[model samples]
Target: MRIGLAPEVSAALRTDPGMLREVNEDAALAEYPSYLVADGMGGHEAGDEASRAAIEAFASVIRPGEVSTVRDVGIALEAAREAVGRVAANRVRGAGCTLTGAVLVQHEDQVCWLVLNVGDSRVYLHRGAELHQVTIDHSLRDEMIAGGAHLDALPGRNVITRALGSADTTADSWLLPVEDGSRLLICSDGLTTEVEDQELRAALTMGGQPEAVVEELVQRANEAGGHDNITVVVVDVLSGGAAWHVGVDSASGSLAESANEEDLTITATVPRRAR
Candidate 1:
């Protein structure tokens, strides 16, 4: 991926406890260079505290208008791990939360989106009229599927293998080149479970600002049962980085279905068959 100029970004965040949950266990931080969402797990408000703590760690590392470095992001993530661990210490069952989001970072003289995730929460990129899941899930079902097991064969889908307060604190990170018109959607599992990728693409495809887009997506998840806490963070790059569209075969103008998450380069390939 080619790196370009520093990015000028705008972001919006929305979260709800959902229809069933009495307390919202989700927290987010969206201020220019930093954008993220955390989904807390555990009982008696510990989860909520864990999520908030994680977001606070990130918020402390980032300055609202100033550009941040990749090292700063690392510092923030490590801080979050420590903060969440403290929250978990107070709980008998162990409290934890899934952290996922994108941040603007200057790396090796290039500016890009440093997307990160610790659990099943996702970061999706929208560009060239195509939607790509930038972050992979750290959940049991997803891990099994990636290892060649069938998704339907998995006994349960909610068993996440990684989280802030869990044994695993390291998060997977990705560098996505910032296209001028590209948008990033950071969300918790609640939204992904209810809203299909196609539906999400459609909603994001509609014309509107970042705030309007995020609000509509949260509303969509609620309409679709809203079994858990829902959170959405939308980051738009009005201008930044090397400008390039994704998934369009130069030979044909048609959009390509398969996108590469295995590597940073988002290439067009064969369609992925659902298992």
Candidate 2:
């Protein structure tokens, strides 16, 4: 598929010094299409470091000129988790982070996108006129809702139950088929917590380019309070042609477009899935 990507990452207000609202990280395999996002947790500077560390660990494998696979992606994530755990174990006094990511792997005659996560970060698929959040939140509110809680009661009730570098280390991953023209939106809690799903649906349904979608999503988050670091990555699968799998590269550049603009990091790859 022709996958076009756009991403953004922002810090919170001037309140918490050096404390980003969210940390944005992604991985695009060299032989397969993959994407990732990590939201960190630690006090101020420590939290930012933890998130950046996880991203660096994952990026090491999917960086330009590296050959990677579905298995490689998983291994890379595991390494990232382990590395973060070790760092938090030695460096900080109770430091952790949440990690969420997605990868497009080829399966038989179809391409499937896998969602991997350990916290409240999310993966949403925009199909037709509706947007479906494929990943479940590992939080108390989500659990209560799953166990039958009122929709209105969900506000301020759902709190993260699992996160990377946190007390929990296990990450739940889901596999979804990648159809032609499917659009995948992955973001940190900063964006989702503030922006309403209906508004999110409207923005994604606008069918704008990936760049424009990121802009709108950021704006929505800021309007919602910008209480935390906001990060978003939008990937649109343009075609089903297998020929698009060859020739992939990681483009490095600053993502900030304005004071509210976020820091965006993108790594693109197309590799064969290893059995």
Candidate 3:
């Protein structure tokens, strides 16, 4: 089978611990066709460890220059769950993390996106002038809403009902057809917690480059009372012609250290497979 993203696919990413937090428990990956974000939860170092472990598991299994199948993605996530479970076993508080992202794959000789999510982290699609959320949140608030609970009555709306490192690590996935010029965004609740959906859509459709758009989004979240760790990955689908090359720019800082004064941005581009 042909491997690698179509010549048109390119992406940019950014992450921040937020204004109020001392440590950033969020981790993200922006490899072409494999964009992901993980939000760690627990206390102290456990949360950071959980998030790192989950992303590491996927990194180990997904090669840099290969196309991954749905089965491959599933196995990688299972490994991540096991790794997180190991982290939980070592901590009295029991660590966990949210996993959400998308991978590009070849389906019936056409390139399609396979989106996955566990917890409230989200995947959004911006096509033409419209924006769409691609994943359902696995949070108690969503459950209540589904059960006819009023939005005003749900005070614990942020409490997630599912995550990695627990017994239930079943991730919901969707395979979507590719549309040229479409943009995909994968982000943590940090960005969503502070920014409204309309705001996100406006930022995404503003016609800015992926790098600028992500930086602006993070900046906006911080300006809106940066209450949680924020992370964003933006993927741009272009028309065929550009060569495939991966560029990743990640900031170096520890969760234990004070939040970096500068935003941590990572960008990567994967070229299309040669015929």
Which candidate gets the maximum TM-score versus the true structure? 1
Regions of model 2 farther than 4 Å from truth: 1-32, 42-45, 63-68, 149-158, 241-275
Q: Can you tell me which runs of candidate 3 are displaced by over 4 Å?
A: 1-7, 42-45, 240-275
Q: TM per model?
A: 0.86, 0.71, 0.83
Cα lDDT tens digits, model 3, 96-175, are: 99999988755445556767788889988776556777777888888898899887888564778888876567677666
Candidate models: Cα lDDT each: 0.77, 0.59, 0.75
Q: Please say which candidate is ahead in lDDT: 2 or 3.
A: 3
Candidates in descending lDDT order: 1, 3, 2
lDDT of 1 by residue, 147-188 (tens): 899756885557888898988766777666677888888999
lDDT-wise, the better of 1 and 2 is 1
User: Which predicted model would earn the best lDDT?
Assistant: 1
lDDT score, residue 40, model 1? 95
CA lDDT of 214 in candidate 3? Answer: 95
Q: Provide the global lDDT of candidate 3 against the true structure.
A: 0.75
Query: What's the CA error at residue 126 for candidate 2, in Å?
Result: 0.4
Alpha carbon deviation, residue 76, candidate 2 (Å): 1.1
Q: Each candidate: RMSD to true structure?
A: 6.9, 11.6, 11.5
